[model samples]
Target: MSASAGSPGGAARSLRSLRDLYDQAVELPAEERERFVAALESAGSSHCAQLRRLLAAADPSAESPLDDDPWARVEEEEGPEPVPERIGPYRILSE
Candidate 1:
């Protein structure tokens, strides 16, 4: 059956396990596969919280790399200002 269609009780949770799902997503590049796992874990409070926690542990920066990028580009174009603080668990502590 299709992955989505077959999601029975605890199935989504079981499927999110890296040990279980990683092989299925082998066609995905490493980075994308990691991100997909992250999203699933952050799906939260359910049975599959491990993936989200693993992603954070595996790559702290991956959680919000985009936030830093725009700020860096803005500075290169327009000079520096005080950086914003704390996007969730992250902090822009300096300019």
Candidate 2:
């Protein structure tokens, strides 16, 4: 599919924006980090669960061997989300 072929859902759009905001907010310290995390968690009610699962999967500390692949688990939970046909060499696996 082309770059413009699929459109992102509102939740995906919101998560992308929130990720950008988190990147910028990293500069702030103390209670700022807590507030930022809280706000993001609150704002992404619809997408936060899947986003959290993705985040955990991406984290090295959480890595563990499982009978089922993390990507498969993600697919089961998220169903599908708009992703480009290719993101460099990696494509989002879907059912």
Candidate 3:
């Protein structure tokens, strides 16, 4: 489930306290991100979903927000731009 999908599961809601810490850590140099993640994981960050959520929020490019149903309640978030198209190796062509 997504924030956009209104997922307020315990795991999602429970991570809010750690948000500020995560926000600070995520601002580490991009090259340091992996080490930071690894350190966190090694330091008993065992909850996979929670970790993924933090990492995903930290780096939006790490994953796609909506992989299906482009018309599924995204109107308020992104306006009415058409679903974007991938261009060449690394670009999106959108309205």
Estimate TM-scores for all models.
0.26, 0.32, 0.38
lDDT per residue (tens digit) for residues 1-95 in model 2: 43331456655666676576545555566446556556767876444455445544555555478645879889889888776777799876763
Candidate 3 TM-score versus the reference: 0.38
Q: How much is the lDDT of residue 6 in candidate 2?
A: 40
User: Between the candidate structures 2 and 3, which one is better when assessed by lDDT?
Assistant: 3
Candidate 3, pairs of clashing residues: none
* Pairs that clash in candidate 1: 41-52
- The per-residue C-alpha lDDT of model 2 at residue 60 equals 50
lDDT of 1 by residue, 1-95 (tens): 45552567346556555545544444566578666665656775342455445544555456665556777788899887655687788977665
- A best-first ranking of the candidates according to their TM-score comes to 3, 2, 1
| All candidates in order of lDDT, best leading | 3, 2, 1
Q: Worst lDDT window (10 residues) for model 3?
A: 1-10
lDDT of 3 by residue, 20-84 (tens): 54675677877776677678678776543465567666675665656557675687677787654
